[model samples]
Target: MLTGQTLTTPQVVDVANEHEVGAFIGHHTLAEFHGVEPALLDDGPQLRDMLTGALAQSGATVCDIILKQFEPQGVTVLALLSESHASIHTYPERGSLFMDVFTCGTVAKPWLAVDLLAQAMGAADVRTNTVLRGDTHPCCQ
Candidate 1:
């Protein structure tokens, strides 16, 4: 043992060891955007198009999506994404919506998707909740 150094055992230390540190990516950002909307979500085709556009902006491709109108002022939408999935429930009379986006990959941009939904529904003064996902390598130790 010296002043600036220490003695070591005969074992070898591999400095070249490398590993994958994937971003805290899955479900990285989940936001709840709600506000007063001037439109209703009852048109299946229209809803599909809006969601499709949102996902498209974030470099994602949609395989399939489904939208259902519960009533005059209520609706439920289930959206499928190549990375994962997202959904929204609208209450027209209340002019509010409950939205969720869960996905994994570099293409996961929840903000873009939420913004598109807000624009499509004509929502103003929107609110949001962001949940960043995390993934760790158990073997990192």
Candidate 2:
């Protein structure tokens, strides 16, 4: 259960199975944003800011961030989160970008981060995939 105060913090939960005893601690979200403004994808600073804001809004703690701009066009922003990590790689020519957010607990919402980023990038088309990690399930792993 999450209260307002605890919503921003990672909470450990027991996700043990009959065969194994451990915690299911990973939530990974991968997204592709299409039909965005090319300029937005080329701006490293703006992309970093967008990712930082999205992580914050999704209740993930940012440890550090690094942004790199490419020669012709494009940008990449990587955020190190207390929960796990998140990254964005842009393709300015295609007006698209790929985003990934993975958190190591149940509290932080990785999907929300993807949603926020997509909206901020003004993506006209968005596709997302979520994988629950730290489990023995073949599909999840």
Candidate 3:
């Protein structure tokens, strides 16, 4: 019972003299950043700037950035990109944060964006996971 806009779509192709459609392919990077300074995690505007800058540097076109500051202490930064999207959710009390950067097509580097964000935040430990989404091989002709 969930509905939302999809970032990519299947493409039409010809395979074996017939018709075989291909799935969408994209790069998604998920990371957990630990040991960051607490103060750094609570600043909404600062986090927004950092994420957008990182995405731009990684060759992603940033469409818009949304930031939310929590009651006690925390911030969430979401960057809407032409390719896809990127986000950061913080836990200031624990000095940790979760990040995600997903991009469609080969032009943007999601991994590089994660690296830049981690470096800018000066995280002591960063655990990351990269996923190749959709069909690995597309037979578009």
Candidate 4:
């Protein structure tokens, strides 16, 4: 099983519900979209373009793009953005893609990448794992 980690401390939270203080009142949603088409998976330019567009469309600018490819065109692309990062690993043989999009202070945008992937893969369907990014509850008033 693949698990994830999220940091949360009391200093990070600030009464989420009411304006009762509103410290940790912000939310950041992280999502993983996987299971993409296999045939269209290629590394380098394709991956770079996708990663770049995904971040840019989400109101984040990419400062760096790292893409690696394996035999049979299995590509892993990591995009480092000003706000956060978005990554995609495509398995061409299985026609699957493992994607992670995360942001710190803003809500993550999923449809941009999803649309691009669907076009790139001609995917029949896509799946998503949306994590609410659990953090510490602010007890301080």
Candidate 5:
């Protein structure tokens, strides 16, 4: 089980074996940001840069990106990476941000992206949940 802590590839493989999965394939990390800097959430351009920088910092290959700014004040950015995808949604009024970083293959680490995002957003508090995606355990189905 992933405890929202960074895991080595060998550790993940061991988890896969324990769970009866053929192999550890990929994982996803969901991070909730509370009390983030309001400007970071409200500014589309800045948020875009932050997200793009986070992806690059995590060693993800950016394939395509879409950034949308809301009418009142908010932004949503999605980056489709070669490994998988990373997305961010912000609510400036509530001073909250939600981010998801999913990466397939062993080359990229999703947790690294999450860490970078938390720092870039200046999150006062963060809650993260990570799950092993593509676990083929029969009991899990």
Candidate 6:
């Protein structure tokens, strides 16, 4: 598992309040998974289940989801959540997986879902970037 710098709760609150009067849009985490098990990447059902479980663990309300498998190898899974959405794409040949989790509202933690997906995929290394999305102007309120 890869560890990266995380924003403290106060920092998050401060960012959220930076644009006074406007509601926080959401949090989005993009992850690059390296050295993941090939078998795990090719298993569409397993990947789907992992994403679903991760979303549930993150307190996201899953609205819809879809999984697609390519010929020979590779799988793609997408979950639509009440907060936002999460998706996973696997490249078994490259021993890599790419994932994104975006969640709206203060109650959901998209980073948790990213971590869970990395763990479930048996990643040896993970690189992640998180962005706070939404209107930043105070007038947007």
What lDDT does the true structure give each of the candidates? 0.58, 0.79, 0.79, 0.55, 0.75, 0.78
Name the regions of candidate 4 deviating beyond 4 angstroms: 1-37, 107-112, 134-141
Model 3 lDDT per residue over 49-87, tens place: 889889999999999998999999999998899888999
Off by over 4 Å in 1: 1-24, 32-35, 136-141
Residues forming the 10-long window of minimal summed lDDT in candidate 2: 1-10
**Candidate 1 lDDT by residue in tens digits, 1-141:** 111112112221222222223434454334444455436554556666777788787656677888787755576777788677877776666666677776665445665677666666666556655554543334443
lDDT tens digits by residue: candidate 6, 85-137: 89999999999988998877666788888877777666778888777766534
**Could you tell me which residue pairs clash in candidate 3?**
none
lDDT of 5 at 111: 73
TM agreement with the true structure for every prediction: 0.68, 0.80, 0.80, 0.63, 0.79, 0.82
Better of 5 and 6 by TM-score: 6
User: After TM-score superposition, what is the CA distance of residue 77 in candidate 6 from its true location, in Å?
Assistant: 0.4
In angstroms, the error of model 4 at 74 is: 0.6
Pairs with backbone N, CA or C atoms under 3 Å apart (clashes), candidate 1: 28-133, 32-129
Best by TM-score: 6
lDDT of 5 by residue, 1-141 (tens): 232333333234234233342344677888888878787788988888878888888878889999999988899999999888999999999999888988776566787787787776667777777667665345555
Ranked by TM-score, the better of candidates 4 and 6 is: 6
